[model samples]
Every structure is written in structure tokens, then in C-alpha cells.
Target: MMDASVDFSKEMEALTKDLVGIRSVNGTAGEREVAEFILRWLRSFPYFTTHPERAFAQEIPGDGLGRENVFAYVHGTKEAGTGPRKTLVWHGHIDTVGTEDFGALEPWANDPDALLEKLLAEPDLPDAVREDLATGDWMPGRGACDMKSGDAVFLVLLTYLSEHTDAFSGTIVLSLNCVEENEHTGILHGLDVLDELKEREGLEYLFAINNDYICPLYDGDPHRYLYAGAVGKLLPCVYIHGCETHVGQCFEGFDASVAAAEVVRRINYNTALCDGYRGEYTLPPSVLKLADLKPAYNVQTAQEAWTYFNYFVHAASVADILAVLKGIVKDSMDEIAGRIDAEAEKYAKLAQQPVVPPNFQPEVMSYDELVAAVREKRAAAEAKETALDDELAAMAHKLRAKGRDLREISLAIVRELVRELHPTRPLAILFFAAPYCPANTLRQEVAGEKKLYDQLESLVSSFGEETGEQYKILQFFPSLSDSSYLKIDDTPESVATLYQNLPGGKTVSPVPTERIRSLSIPAVDFGCYGKDAHKWTERMYKPYTFGVLPKLILKAVAEFL
Candidate 1:
């Protein structure tokens, strides 16, 4: 199956140690360093030395840090005498989250052995962590588990496939992406690279294998698993507007803060909104951000506020997310209005004044409708030569250039639109925010795909029986990953809803919906097991990660190629 002389374990351990020691945290110059290091390592091989074009670092289009993704292509020795046969892809992100959580271990966090030694001596270590350390099987350090281990596995696999072309039937394209921890700029650009390569080289894409980190769903988890699909993420943002009034006139008007709390109360960790796939359910949506848009705090009631949520989806479309969110916003606003009306009548009766109910009719609309309504109203104002939309766009551009975050830019634009449109009081504007990842799965309906899936399941189970390495097969990975860029399970028409509804929709990284949809690359997540990914105690098991994972991944990929 492979060259008996080559030591896969030694190669993996050496590469992983070097990779983990390089502080390639997302949003730093270390991203470039990791890319350069990978390129050099790839070029060291005889195959790449003769074909240097197969190994190089590609710069992402708009990365301000000049970050790059390493690309290594290995063509199979088996040829069909046609143009180029089929190709399988191996994709992994090389970036890691920041090391701030390491605290006292920050100095040694990049050095796994030193960090493990220090951790073993610390009397204050947690009982569970100490137990894992005592076993002498886990390597603790930053990026050791979250995914540098996976990256090293892919690198070593690339070299192995290069040396033993007969191990796989077709060619292989292994890509180490950057920016997955933040904006996902690398893989987004990589979609273009694959498309161009396909056109120029006539290589048909078969599938992609993403080696993101895998972990026990809980402590003492005994079974390892692989997934056929990965989860998708969407951000449903809400901008709340209220009638501002002085604290003395509190009951006379509705404060946006009052409505914001009700929204969170109705939405926080509500499991009913979740979507399930192939016998598994996605984690329920939760608010990642919520804040009032008040500039300087005073006694005046908060008039404008905003919130955005982290929503994971399996089969839900952009339209489905918008509909569910719109329904929630409508109900939350209605309850708020009814409560304010009741309070206004009670306050009047208590003051011995004329009894009356507050009549601020609640209005709710989607971002698309709001923009259109604003356009309709602003046309009249622009008759006197004022371009409302242009003004907001320019302001957002300036703020973004100043390195302001997307959520802040989103809030500013929504606030400006609501303030100008003046859509009465007690209003809610619902919209989607940046960084929308679409969910995809193996296309069972596609010819021969179901067979491949079945073969993989059977092979993994038999392999476990043969080697005593246990694993359960999952239909989907339960987290977000760069594998999202591999394919589109949804239609192009359905994804346009996301493109239209994002704030400053034209400014964000554009997903070529039609182009990506055309390339239906089945994806899977198979990688090393570990725990506490971003914590100071992050670690991966060396026995399985180094000794067993590479062989298993090679076998699984051979089935596809």
C-alpha cells in the first residue's frame, strides 16, 4: 500500500512540531510565515523540484496582511490517455485562533513539549487535565488540536501521494488555507483557483476532504468518528428602533432597550429554531452580539439598538432563515407595543390625568424592503439633489477603511437608514450580516455517489474491526468549517437571497453563487481527535493522531480517487 521504508509517524511528528511552534495566529504576519514554510517543505521533494509550479503560495485578493494559501498538486502515475483524468482535493486551514488564553503559558504555548512539562508540574492544574497529562499520550500547546495536527497530516499525505502515485487512481490537489479563523478569505479565493485549473488542465473535480479538528463531544468519549458533510453558518441581524423620551416621560414612550431585552428573552438558546440533518440536529441559534446604538449615555431613553446572532444550518435555505427571523421579530415587537400601551393607560389613571393608551403602531420590515422603501422615499428628497443611498455607502466605506468591524459598520448603516426613513416608533428591521456559509452534503441522487458513501462506511467499519480503532460514521460534522467553499447543496437561486439581504451587500466578499454551484464537490471531515481547542490546555493525542490518522485518511481518500 505504501513504501515500507518511509516513516509516516516520524514525518508527521516532526512536521507537526515545527508547525505548532510557529505562532501563525489569524490576522498576523505569522500567516505568511506558515505559508512560506509549507511551500519550502513541499519544494524539498523531488517531484516538486522538477515541477516547481505545483508548489507555491497564492496571495488572496483582498487580504490586508498579504496572507497566502499553499498549493501542492500531485498527479497520479495512472493515466487514461485522455486530457487530465479526475482529481480529489485535500483542504485544511493553517491559521489558529489567538494565544491570549494561554495566560502564564503564553511564552511556551507554541512549544508543545515545554508547555506539557510545565503543565505537569503546576499544582493548580485541573484534575481532568492532569489525568490526561499523566497518560503521556496527549501533547498540550496552542494549535496542537484545533488543527495544526490536521495540517501536518495533509502535508505529509501530499508528499506520500507524490512518491507513490499508484496509491491513488487520479491526481490530488492539497491546499492549506489561511483566514479561516476570521473572514475565510483564502478558500473563497481558492474556489477561483480550482475553477481555473479545471478549465486549463481539464481535470474533473471528484471531492474534497477537509481535515479540521475533531473531538470527543464530551469528556471520556471513547469512539472516534468521521463526517460526510460539514455545517453552515448564517448571521441574522436585528436593528430595533424606539420612540426616545426623557426619563421623566418614561411611560410616555418606548425605549429600544426594553424591546431588545424581550427579543433576547424570546430567542436566547431557543432550540425550536434548529434544523436537523440525517438524524442529527444543529445547535440552536444564539445571540453573538447585542447592544444599544446610543453614543453618549444620558437620562434619555435608548432610542436605537441592534443585535446579531450565530445561527448554524443543515438544510435550511436563506429564505427559510429570513422567514423564521421575520416571524420572531414581528411577535417580539407586538408584545412590546401591547405592554407599552397597557403601561401608558395605567400611568394616566395613577396621575389622575385623562386615561389614554399609547398609540405607536409597531412596524417591521426586512432589510431588502427597508432599502427599497428608503429608495422610494429618498427619490423625492433627491429631487432637491440629495443622494441618500450614496451617502450611507460612502460612510460605510470610510468606517471599514478605518479597520472598524463589520458588525459596527452594519449597525451604523441600519441606524442611518432607520433615522432617515423615520418609520414611526416601535419598529424592528431584520437582515442578514456578512460571512454566510452554505450547507452541503454528498449528493446521493448523483450517479455513483451513494455507492462511494456506502463503500466508505463499510471500509471504515471493517478497518476498525481489523485494527481495533473504533469510529462511528456521521452524516454531517456539527460545526462550521472551510469545507463550505467546496460545494453548494442548495440551488443558485436560493442563495441569492443571502446576497441581497446582507448590509452593504455589495461591499462584502462576493460568493460567485452560480460558479460555485456548478462545481458540486462532495466533502468530508476526517481528522485527529482532541479537546479544549482554543484553551490553554488544548492538546491532541499522539498515539492515534500520529500513529493511526494518516493511514486511515489515505485509505479513505483512496476509495474516492
Candidate 2:
């Protein structure tokens, strides 16, 4: 048995150093080398076995860099009459978002040992300056947190678990995939291959546990959060083409960049339209880049052409939501294009004028299982909110008469109670409302969005499983805008009517009366990438590491399995 008190500090330091040294940055196609190294290490273990041949490879367009996915497994003991052993998938991606200077910070080359020691000494440092060793705090190198730490944690846990096989109830499937930080193509391809293998061997799996963002320690805090669900991503680009002219002659021809800028402004600043899918739709500022706007004939002329590129990253949006968003983009683009063309035609009826052809491409979650995951999360959230309301009601009675103004005190009491009850509201709401929500919807649309998401997920999963190809999909919904707890309508008769429609949608005997509490968004924020992930000096709130992540993973695994 492995020592429960084994100090992993040293081992972790070494692993981090080793990973940082590899320089397996994304975009550069260096993950293949790292993946090969990881496979060799896994094969060296007596209890673990790598695939019979190369598991999978990472392929980048025009770059013949040989990247690969590594798979290792350990069998479980079975009873005499039992059939095939069940499998538990432990998956992690080996790639990291590549650094600008590929060779700038090779791990452990220069004073890495000392840097590790310094980091260990100040484990509670803030995330911003933690990875900067110049200030005696820093997590040097890329992929430290965005997830080399997660990969190391998996190895450590697996190594320990393998040594104590008797303690495990089922077979372990270790999957170290590539290209997660870029397009997730490596993992998608690996999953396809794994499905083929499963089909050939007739293997059944309980569930796949992805150790992508598993953090063991966090800064000090009482409550911890678990990630029951992750919203899918939908990245689309909008291109606007128009007749460009000199800045001084702006009135002659429509400026494509300016016209595109209007559309972006509408998407960002127009709340009623954008926020209509409250808790579901989020349209952040588009990344506007001048794609093509140059001098015509090498001389300053009023007649010029330009193109504007708008890159949008939408979160948790489903196919229907994407369609709606695309429609909005199309309409906006057409309106702007038409206005520009109309204005340009008035000035000069040039035979060939630039046009804004609605060109939109979506980058979505490449698996149906991911969509089902969001549905599961939504259901879980609904259930949790229901249970929390009950607890808050009980707590409210206890604080009814504490020498405070009843009405004012009740509001304050409810606010505090709601915050306590739904701590994840902020994060969940942001996910649902901003990035995940769709921009367009018919006012008459009713419930069944959840069902729609589940169906889409099932379809995607079925397709992936059947075809052995990866598919990306999205999930969308409406968001509640309020930051406070959802107001529970307290009208006596209305309450009775609400309970009557439970479960079967038919009136139950003796309809119970209860207040209908409104839901509120929680308050949690994640800094941009390169800000929070692993660095030799990376630090997180103690509560996040110890309390939230562990509890979240444990709960998710328990529920999923």
C-alpha cells in the first residue's frame, strides 16, 4: 500500500519541471513528442500496459509534425462467474496552449529547482504574480496550470492506484490525448479510435472521468464548488466587405470596417436583443481585424475596397441557438451591406461593388456526450435550487422576529438566504446568459429547451459512436438577468396552481401552497487564460483547491458513474 502521508511536493515539483522543459506548446505541433515520452513512461510501469501499437497521432494542416495520443490500461480482478470487466476511463490531454517564444522558458534548465522551492514556500500567493520568480513568486513555463498539473495529478493518482489494484473495483483506462488547447482534434480523433477498439473488443465503460482542470488545493475558504457541467463552445467568424475610401472622403463609398463596427456595436450594446436569451445568450465584443484594406493603384483615391473580420466565441449555445445567432448576424450583415450598397450606388453605379456575403462558420463541442452533460447539469441545478428553497424557508422562520423591521428585514433575510442557497448561481448564470444564450428566439417559445439539448446530445453521441468520428455541438438557453435570488411569488392561490402542475402536468390531490422563488445568477469570475493556470509560482484560493474542486469532482463522478 502506498503511504497515505507520502509528500507529493517533491514529485509534483519534478513532474512540473519535466513538463515545462518539454516545450510542448500548442500550434507548433510539439505535443507529439511529449505524448510519445508520456507513453514510454507509462509502459515502463509493471502494472500498466500501453496499446499494442501507436494509439493515435496529432495532425496539423500543412505541418507534418507527428503528434499522438497515448493510452494505458490496468485490468481489475473479477469474480468467477462475472463476464467482461467494466472500465473507468481516466482521460487527460497532454497539449498546452503554445507560448509565443517556443524555446523561451525550457523547464528546470536555469535555477528551476530553486524556483520550485520558492514557490512551495509561498503556496498562498496571488495568481497574478505567483508565477513571476523575479518577485520570489512564479510558476514558470507554459502548460503548468492550463493543465500540466492536471496530467501530473492523474499520473500520481494512477500510479498509486495501480500499485494497490485490490482497492480498485474496475479496470482503468488512461487516455492522454493531444491538441486540446488548440482545436481538440487530437482528443476527438483519439475518442474515435477508442470507440473502434471498444467495438472490436466489445468493451463497456461505466463513465469517462476527464482530469482536465482538477486542482487539489486552493486559497482558504469555507465552501467549495464542483463543476457538474461545462458549457460547449461555438466560435464563428463574420466577414464584412465594403467599398473602402480615403478617410477624408468617407462620404463617397461605404467603409466596410465602419459598417462592420456598427454590427459589432449592435451585438454588444443592444441589450434587449442580445440579452433576450437571458442566462443563455452572451455576445461579447467581437475581435475586429482589418483583413483587406489597401491603397488602390498606389495612389490616394476615393474608390477603394476593404474587408472586416469579426471573430465571435459563443459558449453553451446549441444548434438552434447557433442558427438564431447566424440569422441575427445575417440580418445585421445584410442590413449594413444593403445600406452601404444603397449609399454607394447613389454616389457611383460601379458595375463591380464589394458585397457582404454572409459567411459564417461554427466551431462547436465535438461530441454529443458533452451536450447530454449540459442537460444533466441543468436538471441537477433545478433540483438543487428546489432543495435550497426548502432549507431557506426553514431558516427564515427562525429569524422572523430579531428586533428588525419585518418587511425590510425579510428582504435582506431572503437575499442572504438566497445567496447561501445558490452559491453557484453567478457562474452558472453567466455561462447560460452570456456565451451560451442564443440571440434570436420567437416570443412564443416555451419549455422543452432542455429536452432539445438532450436530444441533440443523444444524436451527436449516436453519430460519433456509429461513425467513429468526432462531432462538435452546442447547447443554448435563456438567462435570468437579475443578480439577486429569484423572487418567489407568494400569492396563495398562484402557489397552489404551481404545485398542482408538478410531475404529470395534472392537478394533484389537495394542491399544496408555497411561494415560487425566483432564481438569481451567482458571482464567480475566472480570469483570462495565462492568468490563472499553472506556473511554478501559481497559487489559488485554498478553498478552491481543497474544498470546491474535490467536492465537485467527487459529486460529478458519483453521479456520472
Q: Which candidate is the best by lDDT?
A: 1
Model 1 segments beyond 4 Å from truth?
Answer: 1-7, 345-354, 379-399, 443-448
lDDT of each: 0.81, 0.40
Model 1 scores what on Cα lDDT? 0.81
Worst 10-residue lDDT window, candidate 2: 425-434
Write candidate 1's Cα lDDT for 254-334 as tens digits: 788878877887777999888887667888888888888788979999988888888888887888878888888888888
What number of backbone clashes does candidate 2 have, counting pairs of residues 3 or more apart or in separate chains?
A: 60
Q: CA RMSD for every model?
A: 2.3, 22.0
Each candidate structure's TM-score, on Cα atoms with residue i matched to residue i, is 0.94, 0.53
Tens digits of lDDT, candidate 2, 1-561: 234344444454566567656767664556877887776666666565433342233353333466777776665443222554565566666776545332333333223454456444554645546434445323444665555655665565566556666544445666777755634545545545556546654445644544444232344322212221222222233333344446555444444455445546555434443322334444453443323234334433322122222222222223443344446555554555456546655555454745433222212121122223444565766654344334434544444434332222233332343233332211100001111111222112434434433443454455446435343332221111110011111234433322221111111111111110211111111111122453334332222222223322333222222
- What lDDT is reached at residue 360 by model 2? 24
Clashing pairs in 1: none
- Residue 378's lDDT within candidate 1 is 68
